[model samples]
Target: MGKKLLNKPLSTRVISLNNSQIKGIKHKKKKSKKGGPIPVKELVPKSSALFFQYNTQLGPPYHILMDTNFINISLKNKLDIFKGLMDCLYAKVNCYITECVMGEIEKLGNKFRIALRIAKDPRFERITCLHKGIYADDCLVNRVQQHKCYIIATCDKDLKRRIRKIAGVPIIGVANHRFTVEGMPDAFGAPKM
Candidate 1:
């Protein structure tokens, strides 16, 4: 025979529910009649560091771009008047030369030599020739507008007018170490400086 068993399995059992068990069951509460709670306004505090960070990424303003007539004067004088202008630019602003202007200078035959001499100088930086389709005058105007603040150093009357109409900034030339802002009269008048 087998050893006596300690516990016997029940074949059938009866179960009953308690009062707490029946009362604990509940239905979810109905949603509010006023749709939902009003949305709250989120507050975002501003920081000075963020303002300065954005300003630093913007960099400095752009420099003036010169035309052929100015380059011719610089070459004729052999005084590096361009360099002097560039020195002024360095102090108060920056200086730029367009490839179209460079090409025009190169076409000046012997005068191109003078331009080349100045090109080697560190003060002058050539503006890349991306929009080669635009004429030199138009290109200069566009650059000025893009920079928002700049003067065109040129003596061409028509070019001066175009620049004024397009850029709204004064076109100036340096003479006797002084800058003269070219007006409508000077646009038609002979080159002063």
Candidate 2:
């Protein structure tokens, strides 16, 4: 008998529910509106300079913040930074490199000497980084967040994604051996992702 009982499946057992067990269990009911229309009060402060998601601060003599990899990618593609920017934007462009980016280039060492030489060029204005750490990506993102006037130049996908979240900032990168910009309405040459 014990052997036969052990051989039987557990699912074959019959179970019954008591009246209290059925009544004690509560069923979830759909929420019903009890009152009239409710007004939602939300306040979001927007900058006065921003007009319809377009930054009025951006114009001719564009200021561009250069990333560490952007320099290497430009060199690899045989693209001249100054000429490429001018050709793409059709305006005077000033390239700014942060101290963290400079440090990152230096840390890359010997093989990137050519890239290092290009980054140190006098034409590329150097911006002092007050924050700690030598992480270039965070430095670039933070700087762009504080100032919407700059156009970020980067080949890194992660950095581009972060910049895309911020409003009114444009991004420029090398594509088809030429520079392409995005996030600006007037930029016709900017390639769509």
Candidate 3:
């Protein structure tokens, strides 16, 4: 077995050191060349152009598409998912729900009764996914492929991996108390916040 730090024998020199000498200490300053604090945009080159500033005068370029798990998470947490998305995206985002997701939510039965109720929100545009299957993840991927401007809100790890494979697509995940963007497209349109 390796020698433990606490069991290690002290050197005679260290033992011989006087209390006065041991007490004195110096604070070393960093010598590396450091740049001054720059603006948020300057620090991240092309970030401003990539994540768009929310402008009410101009229409938003992106829309939010919700997944089953994402909706359930909102219902579970008692959060206004749409309001959170708008706040994070810094623009009013048109929300959409896929037929496949609805099927998945409905299948959860009474356990997800609240989520099912929330899913009936009229504000969310019901999208008929081209891939008519029971797999909600596959349907979401297909719909997103069709709508390049869509920013999908989901908590599924596997779904996130699939989304990253497609370039210029953004995925939103809830972290702590706020929503986070996983991918920033070249066109940019998230918020500085």
Q: Best candidate per TM-score, number?
A: 2
Instruction: Please provide, for model 1 over 1-193, each residue's C-alpha lDDT reduced to its tens digit, 9 standing for 90 to 100.
Output: 1232324344322223555656677756555568775566796443332342221111233356778777666566554554465344333446678888877766677847867667545777778878846367888876765654556788788987776654245566655544444532223222456
lDDT of model 1 at position 111:
40
lDDT of each: 0.59, 0.88, 0.71
Q: What is the Å distance of residue 184 in model 1 from its true position?
A: 14
Q: Model 2, range 79-114, lDDT digits (tens) per residue?
A: 999998998898999999999999999999999999
* RMSD of model 3 against the true structure: 18.5
**Clashing residue pairs, backbone N/CA/C < 3 A, model 1:** none
Q: On a 0 to 100 scale, what is the lDDT of residue 164 in model 1? A: 60
Candidate 2's error at 13, in angstroms? 70
Candidate 3 local Cα displacement, residue 161, angstroms: 0.4
TM-score of every model?
A: 0.52, 0.75, 0.63
- Top candidate (lDDT): 2
Ranked by TM-score, top first: 2, 3, 1
Candidate 3: count of backbone clashes, pairs at least 3 residues apart or interchain: 4
Q: Report how far residue 175 has shifted in candidate 2, in Å.
A: 0.7
Clashes of 1: 0
Deviation of model 2 at 166, angstroms? 0.3
